[model samples]
Target: MAVTKRRTRRSKEEARALILEAAETLLRKGGPAAVTMRAVAGNLGITDAAVSHHFGTRQELLEALLHQGGRRLKDELNAALKEWRETKPSIQSLVDVIADVYADGAYSELALQLHLSGWRDRGSGLLNSVVDELHAMRTKAFAAGGRKRPSIQETRFAVGMMHQTLALDPLFGEDFRRSAGISSADKPSIKQRKEMWGAMLRAILEG
Candidate 1:
């Protein structure tokens, strides 16, 4: 049975955007569980039914938000690759992009929720687009005849480093910051990130 929602059709886009904005805001202020359709609608001064009309359900809305974030991440990564591939790309540029990709404060906040959501919903596929994009870039790099070519798995893992950089180990934020050194501290900084990328990438390309 095809069920339909009741609401003015004018707010479809606005509703979706508002839902995501609310979700993000919720995650930033509290965490994922704090986000609710009713709360989001209230925040936007809209009705719950209106929000539901655009998202279908709460789960759908969360997944859609992740998917949207993933697509934008992939786009930025692809653009960075395009810039790096021109005229003997440097490891620094690659690392810079990696670091900068998730360095945005907005993404950082949303990413925490996505990770938590992934545990409960393994099939989110929010990052499928980004996963595919990474492979495509690796294939192109190898096909270029003179650049580095990492195994598809290796490419994905290297990209995963961004998440790892954000995760850190054992130390809390303040502790980590206090003990931060060149490589450790640099990994998180956009500037140092490019340097790391360049060095790691150059090694792989030369290998």
Candidate 2:
């Protein structure tokens, strides 16, 4: 009984740590495809069987990790929005928060994966649900105090721009800079990025 209890306790702790690390790595790198039992094993210096024993299946491991990441971002954004609201911040601040949600990181990476999967497997039925959730969030914001709403096409294009910002910006910058004989080592600042986001939001609003 003592041996079993000790093993159980260690297993839970190891699993918890493994999954948490896996989630952070996945967020920083790519999403589900970048995460694997072997990778976690390699990362934590554990056995594949140990990871498998804890996660059971790759799908389950992925779902759990994704869930954890989602919870973290949700908590972060919720706290930020609540604090901002208390200060009576303006509409642009709220728009920046919304834009930041779909900007980058694990959610954005996995979202692209899910979108591609949905295309390959039409019956998977994820794209529409995600679209609905985004729409609902937007509507809630509008009800809160948004001054305008873009048409469906405009909204779709605007969100597509935001969602792919990180991926596209570097590529766009590199090509343009290279053509101008400029090294791409010089990166834009956060202020520049925020200004770009604000400009995009403004364009959508004015559209």
Candidate 3:
């Protein structure tokens, strides 16, 4: 006699996580166009209506993705902060750590998609809150390293520029740079670009 196999039931939280994970994978594989509710539902062997029950609209799903991305980013940023505290913060280390955070193609592509997909109308508040939190962390990190913390306004400017570069790189980074006739020597890698950006941010913070 064979034993019956039981289907594992997921709690609402677990199901929601599953849905978002599926969406993230799809987004990574084919960008935003492939991350519909139906697609996510199919990925989890559920119905589209079930996904809708968890996320009322496509915009809601996208908001959830943004939140998920934000949490992951926070974790990594926190680690970077810890590392900065342990070691003397150098421009190259800062550049390397920041480059690691933003280097995930899926994360950066989804970020750009969220911005372009009318996040302003849908869930800009959520994204803005995340940005604020990250900036606050940056301030704390600077203070930890005995560096002067930048004003909130200056901090916002520095972070905004960094975010913009990360978001656009996937869409038109290397190709655009090459098309503009910038040689490899002139056009630096993401890590190198962040070195310059880090220097600018450090200057603002120190001033």
Candidate 4:
């Protein structure tokens, strides 16, 4: 006679989290095309029905992934901003922080795919808080110097431009640079580009 072992059940939240974790792993390993229901279930030692039960469809899962990524970016940016406030507020540090997030290429590719699939942010405005913080900082600095303060709209536009450039850089920066005869070997270096963007943004804020 053999004794049977029973498996413990996971709570709903736990199951969903595990599923998302597995899906993200798959997304990072391959691209968005690799994050299938079957693949995620296989990674978690579960069934396809389990994933579908939690996320109804692949599109929903991808949307959740984007939301999770946005939350993570928000947290990281907030932490960096706190550190910047404690020390000197360098625009280069801020640009470096954002550039680091998209350096791996996974998030940028996923965002591109989702956008191509007609997926919209749906008013999430993930970077809105970041824009507000930057605006406040610039306003305070300008007032202290007796200079004209930049409008909130101007701050928003500047931040948006930085965000868009960083997001797209991981996907096409090399090619774009190569086309411009910048060399395919990162001759000017990514850090240089980030520094340039930072300087340009600072000028925008000050102007």
RMSD in angstroms between candidate 1 and the native structure over all alpha carbons: 7.5
Q: What digit string (tens of lDDT, one per residue) describes model 3 on residues 28-137? A: 78877788999999899989999999999987898788778777766766666667668754545544554665565676766667778767434343234334655676
Point out where model 3 deviates above 4 Å. 1-4, 121-152, 175-180, 183-187, 203-207
User: Predictions ranked by TM-score, top down?
Assistant: 4, 3, 1, 2
Question: Which of the two candidates, 1 or 3, achieves a greater lDDT against the reference?
Answer: 3
Question: What lDDT would each prediction earn against the true structure?
Answer: 0.60, 0.57, 0.71, 0.87
**Candidate 1 off by > 4 Å:** 1-14, 25-34, 85-88, 104-153, 162-190, 204-207
Question: For every model shown, what is its TM-score relative to the native structure?
Answer: 0.57, 0.54, 0.71, 0.92
Clash count, one per candidate: 11, 0, 0, 0
What is the number of residue pairs that collide in model 1?
11
TM-score of 1: 0.57
* Per-residue accuracy of model 2 over 128-199 as CA lDDT, tens digit each: 333344455566666677646535555556555554564344325447656778565665565566676677
lDDT of 4 at 136: 84
Which model, 1 or 2, shows the larger lDDT? 1
The candidate scoring highest on lDDT is 4
Would you list the clashing residue pairs of candidate 3?
none
User: Which scores higher on lDDT, 2 or 3?
Assistant: 3
